[model samples]
Target: MAALMIQGCGSDVGKSVLVAGLCRLFANQGLSVRPFKPQNMSNNAAVTVDGGEIGRAQALQAIACRTPASVDMNPVLLKPQSDVGAQLVVRGKMAGTWQARGYQERKAALLDVVLESFRALQAQSDLVIVEGAGSPAETNLRAGDIANMGFARAAQVPVVLVGDIDRGHVIAALVGAHAVLEPADRDMIAGFLINKFRGDPSLFDDGRAEIAARTGWADLGMAPWLAAARRLPAEDAVVLDRAGPGRARRVRIVAPMFPRIANFDDFDPLRAEPQVDFGFVPPGSPLPGDADLVILPGTKATLADLAFLRAQGWDIDLAAHVRRGGRVLGVCGGFQMLGRAISDPEGVEGPAGAAPGLGLLDVETVLTGDKVLRPTTGRLVSGAAFAGYEIHVGRTLGPDLQRPLLICDDGAGEGAVSADGRIAGAYVHGLFDRAEARAALLAQLGAASDGLDQHARVDAALDEIAAVLQQSFDIPRLAAIAGLEQRP
Candidate 1:
């Protein structure tokens, strides 16, 4: 099997999307392709067929390859709970939580684990497209780094550096990386990719040549700013701050942006709705007074974020929104925060303590060591069929559950509904993925549904992006670099 690693000049340089597009391109050629990331640090995750979780991006890549996602795809996942620490997941299971410095010290030991997963994928596929985490220029972390250069050299995988030209200074970013990387690390980069270029492709010929001349790395190709990217769910949280088009719409839906927000992908379908205007209200900002619906998004640490919500006076705004007859839906961790209280005696998330919740629903949650990871399908209480997944680490129970929001396929009730039916919550993420469910919920607000099929849209987008990559980059050269054509 042959493999090629895509490392970025920095995070958000379209590394994940590139790997995914490459996977699809090869798969179209009838090659058995697989994707692997040595390490990932994102709260936006996808439950795997193996009953574990990996970065949602990897799961998307697996879908592009037409394969079921496996834990071997992403062996090391760091889920941040706060600025200084994170809960570390290894091989699709929680290992433990560690501070930043502490993790740095411990990560060296994980190289073995990372390589094992990489070898596992390599054994099963004709081609394995590997993705690196963040930039390697942060060389101080280079000593024990398993995410970038360290993993690259260990696996003996040739690298193609990706630079985001849209961020400007494309010349410097590429040349600068060449300057900063150690000789050994620098040697691994066989070529460089210029991403998100706009306007005439010929305009950057000189620029690409300059980079190639200076760095002695081949110019793999320049990819234009792709429209298909918007259709995919972003793994980075920064996308939440993007300003809307200011277009008029029939309904406005807003969600408070929590510091530790998890699974923000849950909102992508709603954001795509034609009649809905959706946005994330940043911390310290008031929940839109005119909103038809306010969402409390899932977070990594429910108690901590719940406290932050109160500190931001969102508790008061939520009260006002409820008073204004606005509808509210809490999801997963957010659902826990909507209950009467949250208890974490084992400190599964943070300090062993209890805190009062927004009390929108008559329920309570207790943090536990066990995390639930399962894909579920059922019908909403509104009688609309829905399909989604569950990924969480708490158990909730109370009176509001008596008026359960939906019944599962096994006839067990899931989620809770308040007495007025204006407030609802569930541990299930992606509850709005199903068009019928989204339609049913929007209908309650007197809005019309556009009947969007998310799966089809995403698949079409993958096709579009793969086509773009095929035309933009020299596939034969890339394949030769990976020795893909040489051997097979």
Candidate 2:
């Protein structure tokens, strides 16, 4: 079995996107390829086919490889609930919550688990493309690191360091990594690649040469800024701050950007609607009163983020919007927040207590130790078919459930709709992915949709990126680095 790991000089350096593109490129060549990340720290998660959850990036990479996503693809997932604490997941199941310092001490012991998963995947594939988290440059965390160099050394996988040229000082970032990484770790890196380059590649010709000459690392290639990448779902919340495309539209939609928001990509399909102007209401700003819809997105911590919503005065804004006859939609944790109350007697999220919800729906939720993770398909009240997944840990019950918004194929009701039909909440993520469902919802909001198919768009974006990488990168060299001969 052969493996190649892609490590970055810093966070948001496009390591995930590159790995996804390479996965597609190799898979298109009829090579059995797999994508693996030993550890991932992000709330953006995707439910696997095995009834488990992993980082959303790995799921996307699995889609790129034209395979089903599995828990083994990402064995360790950390969903941050507080500034210094996160919920640890081992092999796709909840393990426990740990503080930053506490997790650092315990991470080394998980190396065996990580290696076990890697070897399991290695046994079934011709080439396994691995993605490293954060950077190997953080020597302080190198002691028990299972994310970067530590995993690379243990797996005996060759590494290719990626530097973001769009962030400037690409030369220093690459050369600086060489200066800081230990001799053994540095030797693991077989080459370097520059990502997100704008303008002429000739501008960086000398810079690339200087790095290769100074560090003795091969220059893999330079990747240009890919507009197609924007069409794909983003894995990090930082991208939410960047302004979306400006298009003249009829309906205005605002979603509050919570600090611990998870699965925010559920709104990607809405942003693609030409008749909709979708925006994330950042902190310090009130939710726009004239908005047609206020969507409460999913979060890692429900009660804490509900408090955060009130702290930002968004609760007040939402109440006023509802008074003005604006539509409200809640998803997952957001669904729990729209209820009359939320109780966590088990302290599943935080303290064992109950908090009053927004009171839009006549329902109550009790957080429990048991989590529900499943893929589902259902139909809206209007008979529009929709498909989505459920990943939450609570049971909601109330009289409002009698007026369910969706009827699953299993003859079960899901979600609740307000008596006046202006407010709705559901535990389903990816609710608007289906064209018919999205169109039906838009029509109900007095807007017309282009009925875009999100899944197809994502597939097209993957193909586009693969084509670009094939043209710009030296495929033969990369294949050789992965211990594969170039196919004619």
Best of the candidates, TM-score: 2
lDDT of each: 0.91, 0.93
Candidate 2 lDDT, tens digit per residue, 1-488? Answer: 87899999999999999999999999999989899999999999999999899999999999999989999999999999899999999999999889999999999999999999999999988889999999899889999999999999998999999999989888999999999989999999999999999999999899999999999999989999988999989999999988664466899998999999999999999998989999998999889878999999999999999999999999899999998989999999999999999999988877678899999999999999999999989999889999999999999999999999999999899999999999999999998899999999999878887877899989999999999999888888988998887678
Give per-candidate clash totals.
Answer: 0, 0
Candidate with top lDDT is 2
User: What TM-score goes with each of the models?
Assistant: 0.98, 0.99
RMSD for each of the candidates: 1.3, 0.9
Q: How accurate is candidate 1 locally (lDDT)?
A: 0.91
**Residue pairs in clash, model 1:** none
Worst 10 residues of 2 by lDDT: 240-249
Q: Distance (Å) between predicted and true CA of 60, model 1?
A: 1.2
Candidate 1, residue 280: lDDT: 90
